[model samples]
Target: MTIFNGYEQSDREQKLNILNLPSLEAEAKKIIPTGGFGYISGGSEDEWTLHENTSAFNHIQIIPRALTNVDQPSTNTKVFGLNLKTPIMMAPAAAQGLAHSRGEKATAEGLAEVGGLMAQSTYSSTSIADTAAAGNGAPQFFQLYMSKDWEFNYSLLDEAVKAGAKGIILTVDATVDGYRESDIINNFQFPIPMANLAKFSEGDGKGKGIMEIYAAAAQKISPDDVRRIVKYTKLPVIVKGIESAEDALLAIGAGAEGIYVSNHGGRQLNGGPASIDVLHDVAKAVNHQVPVIFDSGVRRGSHVFKALASGADLVALARPIIYGLALGGAKGVSSVINHLNDELKIDMQLAGTKTIEDVKKAKILRK
Candidate 1:
């Protein structure tokens, strides 16, 4: 498959204005408010895991093959029964309004433009139905946080299914809000009302803050909760927030259709090992029983390559999408996807791989 159509001279000139991923981030920092930037960019206390996530990729080296016939490499693959043009998916992130006015809807549109998949967070500024509609029927997954009220959680699941969500991503790592120093200092509050739960009354006495509701609801999740969620949905259930082989096995045994290995972008757990560092063991434990999806600290095509080589069937992008959105809404988001797709294609050709499967088989050496 043609992962990225070559850019025109005009388009190239426009892209040169934004350039690379770090440049996009630098641009985003200039536009985003201090509180919003802090919330999106900061990890938990000390930020050890945050730094480790990206640095882990540095510990491994890709050994490219020589002189292979890779004149027309394809980046197409199937994951969880969805035909993905590229394995790089837009990771579920909350409160997109903080990044852009259009919020999750803009993200959906951007992902749809490139035939990429999106996982919409429960705390999204756009409702599941609205986000699905915005995608114009592109494949979308619902990222669910199990609520203390089982009825509420089940109702949300039903709403997502009716709205045409292709799968369910049950996030398991956030039982409580992380002690983010930035959020604490800025006293950051979700800028927009959560579209999905806007009509639902806040009679639970959890107050009106989004973070409070998220923390209270997520506290109810357990291993049995994973099994319950799987049974509740006919669509595939992907358990996100898995960080080790042990939890990976537990999630699989609980009937998860897929495993998402993450640390909530290092937004949770101050000093945890990087998600990439745990990916190999998690993949081994799953043993191909289910696909392993990865996120947290993927910033470039090389990071994408390393994640796949480490046994991630597909990788997700998070903070970068927000950065893109901060720079230019849907167009900026599309640019980020296009840039990554183009980079991945070039990396595959350079690495002498011709398909997504070839990427899976590419050699790697630990430094």
Candidate 2:
């Protein structure tokens, strides 16, 4: 059982009391340093896509059904043979240590307590084995950022699988960093050691910074690489950073078990459509061949409900989750997951739905 197995949340929120995502960010801002906050919160260039990612939800109205059996509304779903008590999961945001001293271990602990799941990043401050242990048997997936050295990936994948990783999420969008003006204006770098990366880095790693590491990444990746990684790991591979129907189809053909729809939380491009705006079309393209996961601009239970209706198997968020970590350590992340799940349950009841399937069949009109 989790440390807060029966602890009341009202009493627990003393560290990070929050009403919504915005409030969560505000509360966390009171604690996290200036540079760290900007790195996590700010988007690329002008961040138009960043603003649009959330604002797009306002235009998509949920057509609530009435007079249905909604008494036993359930927010449970399964991904990669693991049960997600709630449909919302954590996106693989790197460098979580900057937000809290405990970093990914704290996140794993928090999610473990609440029956939630997460995908740990290649740049995580905590290693796969340690994070998995902190999870206390929670099913965890690992996200990969392929390096120039295939040997590094080979060792990393071996470590992750041996550590009991449930699946692999390959992020393909960010070969290089987005032009986040905030990081430049503040001249910030992650002060904490990226535990998973240092061992893989060459020649002491001091000369090879995170930016340099990304710069040296294999940029000419193709569908062939997906097939290669899947063959190597012998585990389910979800090709992340897919923004178009074509890429989704290619990934599916290349043996991707899942298709992740994301724009790197609008931290990649300045002028791209909101992830939600294109989710339906991408889902339509996949046509049930594989589970389509979504991230970018998910801040509410209604957003979770809508994404299901739009054809997402699971929804994810990053910045708000990190903020939760910054505020209350393990419990803070637990509260965020529980808070979103609670809203999803209430949404299912009020919208005349009962199960995860019903939510998928929910009527939503994009205005």
Candidate 3:
């Protein structure tokens, strides 16, 4: 299907007026509670990495080509055995109830309708089963944080498979929660219980009961654990939170089908390099052995182009999805995806590239 399919003129007018990433974020801030906004928007410690993630893109310049036949540029590509309409997919962010009543379910529905993919978070307010059901046959992946209890981890993997998850994204960066000043100042507590973990509680189940399990899982994750997870699950394994070439190589060596370059969106490490800054190095190290997925600080279509030109096979959107979720639930989320898709196509046409493969060959200059 073409990018313009089902995008009406009214939708374009509405999006032009109030649906860009920054505007949507502003709208979300006005609607979401102070604590909720803080949890979704703020990063760890001083937020140096947070600012750098987007700013790092400015250091690179796209050198567009002129006089090329580019009537139709295809954003379509395949990853993790799923054919995606665009290279962009929604990154896994936890506790969507903080933004809206529908939480992850709404996000899943929006993405599915738009033919996008979502990686559901381990701390999601909605259960994997419900989120998968919401996808309505759209592709979905399960983001897992290793649990100290091997049995618990195995149980989660079993559940994901049963729920129809297409793949497993194992996050290794956040062994412990980051030091976010917003959460400290707002005294934020999750608005809803973690749906998956809540099912395991003995009585009066709540989010607090899952803390010990989460902590244990984080502390127990290791490089060797990657192999164990791959061995245990029939689903393809994609390792997320890899920032350096060394770690990227390690993940590929450990049998990862995909290497996701992220710094936990600057939410875990205060001094980490932007995901874009490290994308080329990690991608080079992986050497096309596995698909390299990138996240953190992607704000516009130009950023998406730069990532692909640099080395990322695909890109993921994080905070922006939450912003859309806050403002309009499924509709808001779909608007964000549609806007990005539109921008990506325009950017590709301007760059004289006509497909996802051509994006890799597009010329870029680091400033």
Candidate 4:
């Protein structure tokens, strides 16, 4: 039985009380369909890599320094030229409508309240414009999926800029969808209709707008689309899903200002290296020319420290926030982030660091 098992969400405020990441997973599992649950919760075949993602953090230990006047520690981190209050940024999750009625709107608002950022997915249930509006133009970024059609691609970039997204994050990892057993078994399609496509095309059709554009472009359009989108918007571009130094180099060549070292939470491509494992190398390859961000298996403040030591300028968490949302919409989401923020501050103080930059200067061991 899971932590959320047999428990009921009593009220709005109570939702935020669900502090731990796994604490809310149970509620989400019970509320969503088997397929939907599987899509969001399950991992690739065998899920060994998923388990390893979290377990890998176990090998490293924080060597904290004591006896200094460490009072209020700053958990702030900057990404794509924006300063956020916490090292935690909201990961781009697709089909958020599957988790809550208000979906990304709730998420954006909650993040706005905390003065943080959420990397809005191109596949989000709410339109990017609408999600930004919900956040009232708070610090925000757009995650892009290169579609087959360049026109649709350009249109979406235009929309992101018009909607007040401060930057764009291009997802290059999902060239083809990964082998997610839950999505396959459940035959998962997004629970909500693709609501954001109407602005690009006027009818109900698969691959409309970005999807259609993505289909047409395939591998042939990737490089050009990257340049095109960058040319079209002054907003900084971050290339996410880069797994290697080579890809990182390519991202830089294409004028990307940042890269997210992620493997899609082990949801795609089982048996791949953990995000933390490759972080150091990726960061080195970029030679500090641009910032490197990471997601996957970051469950605690120490894990946040580990990623920073590994060279991530910012770290993001997905399932944890989604788990929080499942238990209670906006408030639950804030609870999870706040919990991390509290823990991070405590951890930094214990480590004798007063700011996030100090975290970078602290020593780390990979054993």
Candidate 5:
């Protein structure tokens, strides 16, 4: 059994049989606070979209090829001019400090160790500079939540550029928090300083709900916002939260360098189609004009492979990586990513795919 650092299983690993994402999540749940876990794990309203996110993967089936020289396959890919060892990037999640002392710093170091990228969230407890310092020169992108304040937005972008962010991820779907009942029941409230928001916005949001804080800050985002961010940052801008080809096209028309297909991990728009279900259409619409980064139901190497085959250039997930971070800090984060990549290698070999490109071209049946 492998543990953090990729070798030498500890008793925790052995006891938990922590070999898959599900088991990893189960273990991490025990250690994190009740409300924290609920906030991390729950979805909006009835949680239909959340459940659909993962379950949707089962309907897509891969037909493996036989007798290909499939030895020594690689998972390496390039995004935004950055060479990454794996296409599985970490999706941005907020308030990682609630899970561990080091938070995004630990996450960046671990991902650097594993050769993937981290999309640092605007709400991350760690600042861009500090997170970049911890990454030790790994390529990282900054996820923008387009605040209602223009000065705040410009200042945030300015800081990202100074900190060496390779790209800007403009998240558009969540202008406010979804109606997550779990949070209501738990009375969930953030309890730490948001380092990036210190100058313009700060504190633990002591008396506010997640919804209230988000509502006060998020803008009525528009395509023009995309243009402005691209112009200001002069960095590749990936428009996240796209569910339709039309929206994807709108973003592209407005100067978005990339299109990110997600449903906010089912934390927004509860009745929507699984993010995976809409990917091929959106990717088809993009028509290879830009890279597609996907998330919201990924839990397996086959899921990653399927997303690639379906059209995503890269796959990302937050719940699993953060769960890993909660359980073991940087090494835990490394362990989670390394395990998935190992599974990706095995799945590629079993499917007789020789490279990441082969996975992209491999046959898949949507049942």
Candidate 6:
């Protein structure tokens, strides 16, 4: 029997048969470089927001309906005009090579097998072309980091368009990198050379070229650059890290076709509202002009259902998927996704919903 088949096993046996995301995280903590695990798993000071991200969901419950036929509930949803087999999408994660040799390419391949959407990080270890090739021409979105030079930024946008990325996600919240204690203690810099950044810092003399340029541009550039990049890319622009309704409106006004409501998985602001807490406001702010994607505090199919019920059009997860990859590479990742999909199907059936559209139809009570 396959490892995932827990038919006659006890709950404890099933739990220990093979590690899930959390167990994999513990295993990864033991195997990966001290700094990398901390960077990926640790949140801001005290990790209060990080705790809040996950815990907040528990306060909101899913009121399952009774006395309804739920034998064959459908779990399909379309994002950016593409029909995805499930509503879950993979979030953009950088330095994946640090986690595994297959890196983003392996992730693309695994995600392709299940018809999942993969979002490529701007700080990816592999190039855009490599990821696209690995996805076998599957629809992927390019996540962009705002830079010091508009011309150079536009050039990257052109490359993404040429690479066949379905959309562009501008990470607006990370105007500056946060104080990540894990990276500080372990010294985890991106594994690959950012060729575009190298030339931009010709004479910083301190031998800190890329990080310096990154820090300087983060402080110097205005939102106008974000507008320009959106104008330049024909692909739909998705503005990520939008915490407030005002920023959501600003992002929409800047020509973003989608808004990803995230707190950088609580890797950034420590005292800010949880990603789940602020999602409803952001969705209400947009008034349906664009689809709202959510991240931060998602680990199970129940969490996916919670986000959809709260108003997220789609949901993505970073650390869990990373843990899945670290534990078993592509197979581990595929297992987690497939499990989540299965749970989602059962959850929908139990809730008396037969379609993705019906997911948003549930009546949720908020305090």
Which scores higher on lDDT, 1 or 4?
1
The pairs that clash in candidate 6 are none
> Candidate 3: worst 10 consecutive residues by lDDT?
1-10
lDDT of 6 by residue, 1-367 (tens): 1111111100110111243455567776665556557767988777889889988887677888888756798778887898888888889987666566666877787778778899988777567888888999778998888766667577778778988999998887777777777767767655434433434445742223336646655554445756777667767888899889998887788778999999998888899988988888889898889998999988778888888888888899988877666666667667668878887887888788888788877766666
Q: Tell how far residue 244 is off in model 3, in angstroms.
A: 0.9
* Each prediction's TM-score versus the true structure: 0.92, 0.94, 0.93, 0.90, 0.93, 0.89
On lDDT, the candidate that comes out on top is 5
Q: For model 3, what is the error of residue 101's alpha carbon versus the real structure, in angstroms, after optimal superposition?
A: 0.8
Question: Best-fitting candidate, measured by TM-score?
Answer: 2
Clash totals for all models, in order?
Answer: 0, 0, 3, 10, 0, 0
lDDT of 5: 0.86
Pairs that collide, model 4: 147-213, 147-214, 148-213, 148-214, 148-215, 148-216, 148-217, 149-213, 149-214, 207-212
lDDT of 1 by residue, 246-355 (tens): 98888888888999999998899988889998898899899899999999989888889889988999899789888887676778788888888888888888899999
Which residue pairs does candidate 2 place in steric collision? none
What RMSD does model 2 have?
4.9
Taken over the whole model, the C-alpha lDDT of each candidate is 0.82, 0.85, 0.83, 0.77, 0.86, 0.75
TM-score of 4: 0.90
Please state the error at residue 112 of candidate 2 in Å: 1.2
C-alpha RMSD for every candidate: 6.3, 4.9, 6.0, 4.4, 4.9, 6.7
Question: Please, what are the lDDT tens digits per residue for candidate 5 over residues 134-249?
Answer: 99999999998887878878988998999999999999998877899988998877765677876664454333335545866665888988999888888999999999999999
